[model samples]
Target: MTETNPTKVQLVQVDPELEGQRIDNFLRTFLKGVPKSLIYRVLRKGEVRVNKKRVKPDYKLQAHDEVRIPPVKVAEPQELPSVKLNKVANLEQYILFEDDQLIAINKPSGMAVHGGSGLSFGVIEALRALRPEQKFLELVHRLDRDTSGCLLVAKRRSALKSLHEQLREKQVDKRYHALVSGHWPASRNKVKAALRKNILKSGERMVSVAEDGKESETRYRVLQSFEQATLVEAFPVTGRTHQIRVHCQYAGHCIGGDDKYNDEVFNLAMQEKGLHRLFLHAYSLSFMHPKTGERQTLIAPLDPQLSQVLKNLSHA
Candidate 1:
């Protein structure tokens, strides 16, 4: 069934030139915020019809076609809870890349990507306050709350659209560094798997391979290895949610200090060794500039906690 804010409106006159136009395309010009996926859902459910007939997405609409639009039920915009700016004193320290159209930050552990689950504010809201005149600040991609480094933000709508297209086209290159809990078998390995999301009783997102799931891919090479763990560089080819963390676990090497996805006992052991935060960091991102049309690569250095984890783990 389709879930959306349905619009209840009387039939409007269609131009003569609009006759025989596809319903989906015609609706695009009139609607705002309803995703194309939702539109297809509406068509399939017969909420939108053409000339008293159940029309599919490809169905043509003639002039004066009486289209019945279901009552619009749009999701309301979430209000951002207030935050005390003084608490986030080091928020400025994370900025690593900035331009008129974009900005990249070395996002630290303990800061969320957005306000939810009782979080008062995320970095985006803080950044938005920093530049109120810009009118929009959008997250081009996401990094886990406890994972540090290289989070990209788009300053304008056009840049966000272009960069998102690049991601879909597989033109964006992303590389990460992670310290995992076991010695990998190969110097380099590729993990190709399908991942499905299942909600745990505790309300956290849990992922595993399922027959019906999204395809995820990761390529890794051992950079440093020790008695019980290894430091590796990971390159993700697809942007599925928690793609890297889930893939690492599927490979039998959960990332050190990953509380949500990693083994709990192993995580506690790492915590004893001063590895308190998630030992994963986005190291580099390369893409073509949206406005300049030039190739660009941005890098964010490892934070102290992750660096120390490597230092202490390599010797053990």
Candidate 2:
């Protein structure tokens, strides 16, 4: 696909490969370096049109549909730092499973799933750079920057659609291993609460339990216990934003090392025990194969640093 010059009012025709994609996403790819807010603004003002008619951001494009884009200033594409390039190249070592339809990686902690919020590059961008020959690769779902494990990517549009459908139908099973700050009661196995996402004035995102929030559920089982912390497996029944972290906090045991939703005292105590990052790991994922009808389960082992932290706590 040819790149669109943001300085000009450009008209482009959608091809079959991009037929089902939302118009806003299509424009993002076409007008690289244009801010997302600007794109939406153009759409709202009718500066962007499909088939000569105004369309919503969610409007799916059809093959051969003509899209009109208005002139807008866009930032120039900048070269990624060599350090980031090297880090992204090393991502090949983390691949857990890969096939024609999808790929799963034991994503390392501290890497964002996709770049945007102050990050210049992320896993998806790095993967694209690593495999420049591949025309289509997209994230199936997201993981927190500090969370590590079975992150999925789609190799085909059909696979992406199928996996998304499975997620919506709750056919996908995702489980995480988390270490919390308090002794989790044996009888408290399930947490049924509602969560609402809020943005702070500083633009930081947070989640809280609220009566008007979307319904969310999480199942927890204690795996091990220390004097100050407990290791538990969390199954989030509803994938609301920060569901697992906030749910654990609501249950009176905030996840250890979770700076956003955890007690600072607990975080400091855990930090003294060699825990430097959030003690949350996406341990396993199960779902039906997008291409095949059979069920597939993928797992990622805990990072060595996290394992060492647990080992230290056990001896303490």
lDDT of 1: 0.80
> 1-316, model 2: which lDDT tens digit per residue?
2344446788898887677989998989877788899999999999999999999999999989999989987667665445345688789999999988888999999999988889988888888877777878999999999999999999887788899999999999999999998789878899999889999999999999999999999999989989888999999999998899999999889988898888999899888889999999999999999888899999999999889889878521
Strongest candidate by lDDT: 2
Error at 311, model 2, angstroms: 1.3
TM values, all candidates: 0.74, 0.83
Model 1 misplaced regions, further than 4 Å: 1-84, 87-89
Off by over 4 Å in 2: 1-19, 22-28, 33-84
Give the worst 10-residue stretch by lDDT in candidate 1: 75-84
Clash pairs, model 2 backbone: none
